[model samples]
Target chain A: MTEMAHALRVQNLSKSFNDNSVLRGISLDVATHEVVCLIGASGSGKSTLLRCINLLEPVNAGRIWLGDEEITRAGIDEDRVRQRIGIVFQAFNLFPHMTVLRNITLGPREALGLSRSEADERARGLLERFGLSEKSDDYPDRLSGGQQQRVAIVRALAMDPELILLDEVTSALDPELIAEVLNLIRELAGRGMTMVIATHEMSFARDIADRVCFLDEGVIAEAGPPDQIFTAPSHPRTQRFLQRIIAAGRM
Target chain B: MGDTKRSAGRGSRLLGNRAVLVSTTSTILFFIAVAVVVALAPGSDIVGERFLNWVHLKQSLLGTATAPSVAEAFLLNVRMFMIAEAIILVLALVIALVRGVPGPVFFPFRAVAVVYTDIFRGVPLILVLYMIGFGVPGLGLGYVSTRSDITYGIIALVLVYSAYVAEVYRAGIDSVHQSQTAAARSLGLSRWQSMRFVVLPQAVRRVIPPLLNDFIGLQKDTALVSVLGSIEAARAAQIYGAEQFNYSAYVVAALLFVLVTIPLARFTDHLIARDRRRREAGGAAPGALGTAAGAPHDVPGAIG
Candidate 1:
């Protein structure tokens, strides 16, 4: 993985919160513009892994590289590194006090030092494209589950990040609202935005992912093309998880 | 006819069920309390010339506060409270920020914040007033010694109350969802920037009720400054009482403080109600373990 220059190269990443270790010595890589899906049952460390990569959750052991710069090293500018990698959480952490426009423009205006007009203009463009032009003046509390999630995506996209991490972006949505968000994710992938998605939407993962990684416990149990992972998972744990999904009529 | 009577029963002013029963019982209890107090008033000599003789009480109360010799000492009390409240907000917020600051670089400042909160919160306000008001001036230091005892009084009150307000602010800051901080940090905001923009605003909003509750306490504690011989409302009342041998002057001071505090307490209650409504209406993101931003002030024991 180190020999070739991947867009994201995570080596032996480990994370723990006090007594419980969530992610243990996991290594992975994603080439530029590749859509990688992390598939796991609830506590299989998928979200933690993505969070660790985003530097939201610091790794107890390991290294992460975004493009050529090693990000996990001491004295590294974490904010600078994070500006290049956007992340969207399942709960869609939109600032309730601010209007949607301000929420989107905050990163650009404050972190990137863009002028207000410039940030607003860019944010409006994203909002227009996402079919949310009318909602720009609205507060986050006024938004539906789906609208909020899309705004969260647009917020990340406003940074023009090189890589984006999505951690179950649709899990908090209503069944109907889920489609809007999934379709937006589909649009981003169609535009060849490099993304690492941690999701439970099996069919969507199958449709969107170039490579599918099945995590069990705290390690990647299997990884391959989506077809291989979805149709014929090699590991017993992966097979069992898929079997449950299929039995639940989600696959 | 029976159905009509049943419908009227539901809306009846009198002849109702538990609502009428409760209201009637409460009214009876309230009047009984009034009667008991009134019956005991003369026995306690409170109805006599010393307590509530209308003419003597009226003159002393009005002379001491309402139309005082020094711009209405009541006004002085109001002014002192307003200044202290404003300064305490900023000062306490700074101390809370310092106390919550991360990393070892701010160790000394953080340590100072911790010790300040601990000691000031532990010491009685009257003693603290004595220390800063009298003790500091006794040191005979140049800048420390002021001709106006009010300055020393204010400093002392600020020292003691900022600790309490800082704890309230800290509790508010802590009650803010951890995910809010994480979300801000993930957006490339520095720790302080995240706090300034995202976390602090939410924390402040959530804690406004409790913070105002503290302010109400501060407003009354402004009276404690009277110990320094500042001619604020309480001291003025005490002097008037000493001269007239009627404690009705103290009643004026009490009434003045109550007049200011009642509205503030009501506003605090209003904020608390609005906050609860907002939460129930789903303003916060769905919490991680279902309690990040949902539970408010569940861990405020340290502050008290």
Candidate 2:
């Protein structure tokens, strides 16, 4: 892809938790309006990479660029950078004290400095679009796991972010409830939103992602379209990992 | 199956009735036995005449020509408690927030908060009362130091209780999950904004029971201010006891203290019970994160 089309760029990213290294000198480039899927087993640095990109966890050594802005440099306003990107976690961390409308409006009103009426209008529109307008006054604990996850997605979308990160968004839901969240992600993908999703749903990744990167032991061992990676993988580790997934009937 | 279920329910109700009967009999028998033993004691009449004299109780509550009314003097204790409680709430929250500030930039502020809590919490409340009550006035700072001894007593109370209340607030803040802060920060709220909007509300709600517990102690400690010779209820009772050579006035003062605090204690219990029920119903979550709003049961006057 051309330099101007790059939505996010990371160079030699490395992270560690004290003595245990997670991401080891990883490089990634995501293009505009592109949906990239990060697939890997647990503890393979998938979540860490997403947290690093959002500046939630300070990187030990790395440089991240968001649309030509060097966000990792000293004196960069991390809070302003975070405002431009949205992240949805597995645990739907909606402020339980707040109603759905308040949770969605907080970021917009606080960070963007929108008037209360303006924030409320924008939040209501997103809630209606996500089929949650009726539940806007309810607390998150009152919602089902699936409905809460959808509200979380709507919460992120209310920010009107340039890029969104999804970290195992469906992993916490019941199997029957996973479809609603997956459908919402599919809708976002259809609308051409730039996203980097770390997920374990093999089939959903195959359907929604334009490019799939299989992370192994802290690095992307294989990268390609879903058809090539799933049906005919080049790397031995990729083949082995897919075989296990197939044996487990997850693919 | 329906017959079995009905019989089982009847059996439980019968057992409950039998339990109530047995408990009532034992409680009545225990109280009767204690009364007989006390009536047979050698000094029972003397004790009763000295502490439970009905005429003296009446006179002590209403005050006499020579002594101030214990009831009226109690208003000073109530006033001191209310002012000190309000100041403690705000000052303690500030101290807690200062200690919670992160990064090296706030190191000095955090250090001051630490030293403050440590000093006040470590010192005895009565000693603090003595020091500020006597020492500040002893400084002779003109008009500033020459204020009423009641003012010094209130300051002492605020200094000591805020330390305790600050720890309670810190515990509540720590009980909030780190994920909550992460979510707020990821939404681009500054650290202070996240704390102000997201953290403090939840923290304050979670610690209300403990905060009330501290306040109950504060209510009783209002009597400590009498050490400054402010003539509050306890001091009034002391003067009456010395004049009449009877301790019945002390009982009157104790009853007055209990009259104010019992309602507050019940209110705190109700808050705790409601919070527990909400948690059990919410199942794993702390439930609506606790609204710091109106209490279901109105606790008479003089308390929020």
Please compute DockQ, using alpha carbons, for every candidate against the native two-chain complex: 0.37, 0.49
Per-residue lDDT of candidate 2, residues B162-218 (tens digit) = 999999999999999999999998888889889988898889988999999999999
> For each candidate, what is the lDDT?
0.85, 0.90
What does TM-score give for chain A of every model? 0.97, 0.98
In terms of lDDT, the poorest run of 10 residues in model 2 chain B is B295-304
How far does residue B190 in candidate 2 sit from its true spot (Å)? 0.9
Candidate 1 Cα outliers beyond 4 Å, as residue runs: A1-5, A18-20, B1-33, B40-46, B64-71, B283-304
Return the TM-score for candidate 2, rounded to 2 decimals: 0.94
Off by over 4 Å in 2: A2-4, B1-25, B283-304
Measured by DockQ, the strongest candidate is 2
Worst 10 residues of 2 chain A by lDDT: A1-10
TM-scores of all models? 0.89, 0.94
Instruction: State the RMSD for candidate 1.
Output: 6.2
Q: Global CA lDDT of candidate 2, please? A: 0.90
Best candidate, TM-score-wise? 2
